[model samples]
Target: GESVGLHLPTLSVQEGDNSIINCAYSNSASDYFIWYKQESGKGPQFIIDIRSNMDKRQGQRVTVLLNKTVKHLSLQIAATQPGDSAVYFCAEKGDAGNMLTFGGGTRLMVKP
Candidate 1:
């Protein structure tokens, strides 16, 4: 059975610093990846995404990296801000159409 998980349960960063969150997935067949940010009491919001065909992709202040060799993925957030504090999750969608498998979220806390 394939699954996704985060390397850390929480990450704390100073405001304006960069943040990096890591994740690992056991599913080799997955082709699409998405990063999501969920504030308390809110649904996950799309942050950035990368495809298996790409090693890296950047959007606004966020970047997503995919490493197929190790089945790993990472999300990088630049210039962390208080508004960026949230629970972040990485999800993968494979050949199974729209079905997505999400990893347990890692809480991101930005300090002033």
Candidate 2:
């Protein structure tokens, strides 16, 4: 099969520091937004999510911020750890379908 997409870009930061990962979504009609983390050789794991109507959502040691006006989204990780190192992607889905469109991932590198 053909390649589904490109590899994730990388973000390097020190462990115990805060990290911010940013993404820009394509579809304005997209109402649901989710953040996922994919470790090496593993599938994407759900992190956090936000609705189009809302601006922000938070999870354990992670926070998702949405800016619908700019079609921008960001994920913040507090006290970053080595285990938190992974490729992170932002996905969105609309009310019309169950399918999700994923943005290119940003790989997080937590250096201890």
Q: Give all TM-scores, in the order shown.
A: 0.91, 0.92
Please list the Cα RMSD from the true structure of every candidate, rounded to 1 decimal place: 2.6, 2.9
| Candidate 2 TM-score over all chains jointly | 0.92
lDDT string, candidate 2, 17-100, tens digits: 999999888777899999999999999999898999899888899999999888899999999999999998888887697899
Model 1 CA RMSD to the hidden true structure, in angstroms: 2.6
Note the Cα lDDT for every prediction shown: 0.89, 0.88
lDDT accuracy of residue 71 in candidate 2: 85
Clashing pairs in 1: none
RMSD of 2: 2.9
lDDT of 1 by residue, 1-112 (tens): 1244535488999999999999887689999999999999999998898989999999999889999999999999999999999999899888777898888878999999
Candidate 1 — worst ten consecutive residues by lDDT sum?
1-10
In terms of lDDT, which candidate is strongest? 1
lDDT of 2 at 21: 95
